[model samples]
Target: MEQGLLVVLNGLVYGLLLFMLSSGLTLIVGMMGVLNLAHASFYMLGAYLAYSISTVVGFWPALVLAPLAVGVIGALVERYGLRPVHRHGHVAELLFTFGLAFVIGEIVPLIWGRLPVPYRVPAVLDVPLFALAGTAYPAYRLFMMLISLAMFCALFAALAKTRLGLVVRAALTHPDMVAMLGHDVPRVFTLVFGAGCALAGLAGVIAGNAFTTEPGMARSLGAIVFAVVVMGGLGSLSGALVASLLIGLVQTVSIGLDLPFYKALSALGITVDVGGRLHDLWLLSVNRAAPVVPYLLLVLVLATRPRGLLGSRSA
Candidate 1:
């Protein structure tokens, strides 16, 4: 029971972190219909920038400023880089962002070098928040859960209640109607793009130290973020949330389970020989397969429900 509780807690933490990274990407794709392949690059920039800013101004200020800076940069990219490519086609736009991702990936190492930067959690929040099942959970992790929940609430409220959210929702579903309604759709696009990037940056600010702050961080996380978006659905915010938590829980729990197929089957009174067809399968362990779990879930989701968990559009 204690171990089960620990797994649940860890899963919730990880799921929230995944949501932080994925919410922005889903918003951009849902509203703008652009994949924004470089979104994770923005996350990488956020971590590096936050580290630099935090060293000079402290963590509190860095939390506020780094995301704002990234938002401005995202705005510029949407204005100058993506707008021109929009005329060509989505394929061109995708290629543009893909190339930009490569460029940023190359540039990061040059600026920060290959080593991981020391982006530690603040000492004030370093103490244990509480004990659970003989384990002391860090205050920072609890703080992360609270912040992520707040973000989720803020985003939902904004989209559901505010005039701006109404506009964004209408534009996403009916761009032509929104344009005809005398709204500046291009400006809306820019703001949404920037806001999406800001969310990614905010995720980095909180998650950098918890994970790691290094040049290769984006590359490591980029695929998982994309998987979350895809599994959630191409343009569904709620779907993203559901998928993030589900994937996070599955990954965490799978990693923690040390059960080998052989032992599992033995409980059912099924025994296998060393050279039997089931031999390799029986030897496999969850720990060894943990890294592939997300992708595996992705494949299963795609195969079963191409539109994603809560996706409205049909594939």
Candidate 2:
């Protein structure tokens, strides 16, 4: 029972982390209509920046500053890298971002070195928040939950109740119409791209210690983040929130389940040996299939709703 609860807790954390990363990716894809493969590279930049800054100052300062720095970097990329290529169409944007991803993957290790740099949670946040059924829950994780929740709430309010949100939606759904209205849509796009990258950067800072400050970590996890955005429904903030929380919970609980459902089936007169990676031959299919959950969700959701759950209603 305790184990089950713990799994749920961890899953929520992971999902939130994914949401933070994917929300930005989904919005950019849906709004900007640019599938940036380098989105995860921004996440990696956030980690290395935090590591460097935190090493000199502190984690809290790094958390606040790194996203800002990454945001500036994203804005520059939008102005120079993406804009000139905009006229060439989305394939160009995709290729550009893909190239940028490789560049960042190479550059980060050069700047931070090839090691998985240590990212200690702030000393104040290092202690356990509480123990549940003999399991200690780290305070930093709880802090992470709060920060993520707060960011989600702020994003929700901004989109649901503010002028900026309405403008962004108008731009996303009707770029030409917004421009006809004299709005500088390219500016808005740049801002949106920067904001989205900022969210990814923020998640990188929070997850640096909880996960790793490694160069390849972003590459390993990039697809999953993209998967979450696709699964949650492109450009839908509510969908992103729901998908983030749901994915977080699902991944967490599934990975920790110990029930060997397949292994136990023999007692019930059903038995079969599976052939796959030895890593996947588990009694519990959830544990075996843990890493691919987001992709599965992405495939299922896209099959049913290609525009995404909260995507713009096509004319």
Candidate 3:
């Protein structure tokens, strides 16, 4: 029971991190209809930046500056690179972001080298916050959870309460009407894109030490983020949150359970014949199959409710 509770708590922390990374991607898609293939590259950039900045100015300053720097870069990319490709349609935009991701991947090695950087949690937050069972939980992980929850609340308030958010939402369904009312639709797109990137950057800042700051980290995590978005629905922020948490829990819990399939079934008194036909099934362990859970959930979600859990049918 203690182990189960511990895994659930850890899963919640990891899920919030995924939501932080994915929220921006979903926001851009929901408001601007742009699918950014390079979104995770920005996340990698944030991690690297946090590592470097923290080395000099300390973690607190890095937490503020890294995301701001990433946001500015995002805005510049939108204004210069993506805006020009907008005339060619969604395919062109996707290809542009894909190419950008490749460039970032290649360039990361040149800047940070091929090794993982030493990005540690700050001293103040390095201690154990509490204990579950006999295991101590890191203060940093608790901080991460609280910060992410705050971010989610702030984002929700911005979108639901603020004037700028209203304009962005309005532009989504009625771009022409927004333009007629003298709102700058193009500028709104750029801001939304930048804000999304900022959110991803913030995730990187907090998650760098936990996940490690390395060039290949983007490639490792990129697909899972996409899966979260897809399983949540293309343009749904709330759905992304739900999917992120679900996938995070599935992954964490699976990684913790090392029992073989046969044993797992037999625990419930279901005996499988492992002598011949079902031998392979008996050999399968949860740890070995952990990485595939998210993809499997994606397939199952897509098969049953094509629009996702909280997504609209039209989405």
Candidate 4:
């Protein structure tokens, strides 16, 4: 029971981090209708920037400056790379972002080398915040959860309450009408893209210590993100949030579980008298299969709800 509880808690923390990344991606897609494939590259950039700065100065400075730098990079990409591509169509815009991801992937290794950088949690947060049933929960993970939650709240408030958010919401649903009213659609699109990339950067920073900060981190994460966004729907921010949390929990919990579905089937159904490595293979599959749970969920979600859960029907 205690172990199960810890696993569930960890799932929640990871889910929040995924939400932070997905929130921005969803908003960008929902509002601008552009599928920015380079989103995860921003995450990798954030981790690298933090690692570099922390080495030069300290973790504190890196935390503050890395996201800011990434935001600028995202803004510049929007101004130069994406804007020109946008004129073509959403598919072309997607391909443009995809190309950018590969470029960033190559550039990261050039700048930081192929090895994973050593990035530990700050000394202040190195120790666990508290113990749960003798299990120590690291302070950094707690801090990450809090920060992600706070960001989500702020984002929700900004999108739902503020005047700027109202305009964004309006444009997301009806860009043509909003433009007809003389609103600067281009500026809004750029800002939304920047904001989305900034969120990805922030997630990278938080996850860097928890996971390894490697040049290829973004390459590993980018596809899962696309799956999350697509599973959530094209333009629904709420759907993105829900989908992220769901995937996060699914992935984390699946790892800690030992369902051994195939092995169980041997006992329930007619037993295939497997000998030697076959038995061991089934045993190994129990653990190895857990890692793929989120992707399976993504496929299932896409298969069933092409529009995604809680996704906006239009725009």
RMSD of 4: 3.6
- Where does candidate 3 have its weakest 10-residue lDDT segment? 306-315
Cα lDDT of all candidates, in order?
0.90, 0.83, 0.90, 0.83
- Backbone collision tally, model 3: 0
- Of the two candidates 1 and 4, the one with more favorable lDDT, higher being better, is 1
List the pairs of residues colliding in candidate 1.
none
RMSD of every prediction: 2.2, 3.7, 2.1, 3.6
Model 1, 120-139: lDDT tens digits are: 99999889988878898899
Question: Which runs in model 4 stand beyond 4 Å of their true positions?
Answer: 262-286
* Cα error of candidate 3 at position 197, Å: 0.5
Candidate 3 — what's its lDDT? 0.90
Give the TM-score (vs. native) of candidate 2.
0.89
Task: Please provide, for model 4 over 1-315, each residue's C-alpha lDDT reduced to its tens digit, 9 standing for 90 to 100.
Answer: 888888888888878887888888888888877778888999999988888888889988888798888988998999998898788998899899889989999999998899998988889989978888899989888899988988988988998999889889899988889899999988888888888888899899889988999987887887788777888887777777788888887777768656565565575684544564576655564446766777788778767876777765632
For candidate 1, give the lDDT of residue 16.
91
Report the C-alpha displacement of residue 83, candidate 3, in angstroms: 0.5
TM-score, predicted candidate 1 vs. hidden true structure: 0.94
Q: What global local distance difference test value does model 4 have? A: 0.83
Question: How many clashes in each structure?
Answer: 0, 4, 0, 1
Better of 3 and 4 by TM-score: 3
Best of the candidates, TM-score = 1
